[model samples]
Target: MGKENSSVLPVLQWLNRVVSEPHYLLHFLTFFSYFVIRCSATHILAPHLIHHLLQREIQTLLVFAVLALIKGVREETWEAFIADALFLAKICIFVLAFTMDRRLAIWYVLVFLVMHMLTQQPPFQGLGTSSKLTPLQLESLLTEGNTTRLWLVEFCASYSSGCIRSSQQFPELSITYSSKILSFGIVDLGLFPNAAEKFGISLSGCMGQLPTYILFDNATEVARFPELDFETTFFHPTVTKGLLSRHFDLDRSLLEYFNVK
Candidate 1:
């Protein structure tokens, strides 16, 4: 019974997530619509009508995919799965067309558009929006202070999915851990693209590895989240407060930071 309940928990959680989030539900409906449309088209509609509908749907998806590509409708040019919304949707339509029913393509495309617009990407703080930082300002702040100082700086872009996801957590950390020597700040690489060069991060649409968090000891670079392979994302861990705390040994660092002062 306990094992069964444990296995069932994930399904319940997924259902909760689906119901609570409109986008998730829309995606669910898109798939659900596919089955309904497929069954109706295959059984009720004439062969000619089904063929005509399938052809139209396929054509529509192709047109939209081309338009979306040219319009630069995606989040980034990396062509990553989730980050590029319309592109991902394009993939979904194609897969549904081929694997499930070609007639389902345009309906899912419409569903994708609705979900995209409804879940309008709110104005993310991006890299610089949270806290403004000029090169000179950053330089001055990094200099060793009178007390043992540590500055936790997050390098992020507003448009970056990873950056946006972790946006609230960083500020929350600032509220929790900020002190004279211990400080928290953000540099929006989106606003200061050149800053990416100095930090070995890229702002290029294809290569922008965002939300790089660096724990600075005075003027020196002490540590960073995702310290390895900041460029290639074979496996980029989701940036969370718990992950941040563990990576930088935050609790120990805080104790040491306070002990010195």
Candidate 2:
């Protein structure tokens, strides 16, 4: 058990580093490997299987085309759910490509590269920055000297579609409501999965809960959103800026911050 954990830690750490900070050398290696993969696939698959794989790629493109058409039908109609769907579709395509066919996987990488260059935005990379908290900083602030303040910390993973959907909302809340007495922060579960164990969050995909919002008062968790529902089994009402405000009473917190003397 000790050896198993010892081996897993480095792999998770490396992934955290890559996602938090891009390494150009890794990109270069991946790019060079693309051609090698293409050559290998060319020899590995027969003519019929190659045709079938090509069809699969085309079907994937067609699905995106339909989604694009829907979004293009109206300019203002674009919503978070649509973006979420597109993101999830991209993830599905990514996983299926790697599992079903190598050449298709390389094809996705190429297309994603071009798309990323065009948009200057990539998936798995979060939208904006926030009052990000490391585990140590969080512990010190919550448990150490100061015991009068209130903190609303969002525990989230960068890779979670839910987190990506609500990324901008938390920062905007922090800007509008954050003061000396009350603060807003973000702890990326993707970067520090170890924090999940400490915070009592499950990293399992089956849980379907990545972005958990907790309101901490004087080192204790006073309130939380999407409070576990055993009947339905997940946090409901969908996380939004409005939801956060109401769930934690941000207006009251703001008023209290001003009243602090």
Candidate 3:
């Protein structure tokens, strides 16, 4: 028994070390930024062209900063200086834009300010799409044995069809999915279980699944899932039931999509 306990200690120690490493910290920052930008773009800037441009500019700055860090290892000082200068330029441009146009600026500034404030705070650390669990949240969830809730919350918040396009532009801010028990269960069973059923796959204990499996791997295969099709299926009577029943104040475009009267 003592020998077994001693053997397990190093594994436990390694786990702790990996969890507390800097890479995890960077991952958290990346995901949080992506989540904030997505939410902001959908809610605040969807209709406005200028707001969209501003968001794109900020996103561009972030990309360069991340690239600098990745390439900086070989050319440390030069890369670091370039990254820092780009960051400072980003801030100055934002400030100048705000000062020049208060009305349009307010919308963009609010989004930028909120993200900046959130990033600076330690409590907001590691709160991202990748790991549904912040350190404290994970500890509590583990103690309570409520792993299912964690997966549900993350899926509802982070899983989006549009996120893939956005992540392509900003690789550092991409949300990664690891092959964990809870994540596999949610992706396989909860999000698109119907599709999986069609594929003759069981929901239990599946391994090495990728996100592309949730949707058909190609556009040709995608056409088969009628319910997944936004244009034709989204307006179906059965689909509109929930939206109409809840009496959501959606616009004409959205109402038309739901086939709501």
Per residue, candidate 2 scores C-alpha lDDT tens digits across 54-158 of 776677667767776765453221234445444646555675567557677778778767655543222333323346889888988888665438888989886
User: 1 or 3, which is superior by lDDT?
Assistant: 1
Better of 1 and 3 by TM-score: 1
Best by TM-score: 2
Model 1 stretches astray by more than 4 angstroms: 1-104, 107-120, 123-131, 144-148, 204-208, 228-233
Candidate 2 runs further than 4 Å off: 1-129
Worst 10 residues of 1 by lDDT: 74-83
Query: Candidate 3 residues 1-261, lDDT tens each?
Result: 999998687457534543574433433454355446555655544467546566766775686667656654532222233334434544544553453345645655565556454432111123234433342453344345434321221111122222221212111121332112222112223455554454433333222111222221111122121234445333333112122223222133234434532
Error of 3 at 171 (Å): 32
How does model 1 fare in lDDT? 0.65
Candidate 1 lDDT, tens digit per residue, 1-261?
999998688567656666776656666677566567677658877778677767866876687677667545432212222235435555755565654455555656676677777763322233321345675677788873664378788887766666654566777666667666577778888788888889877654455367788888877898876664745344566666677888888888778768978
For candidate 3, the per-residue lDDT at 207 reads: 22
Residue-pair clash count for candidate 3: 0
> How many clashes does the backbone of model 2 have?
0
For model 3, the stretches where C-alpha displacement exceeds 4 angstroms are: 1-27, 54-261
Candidate 1 vs candidate 2, TM-score winner: 2
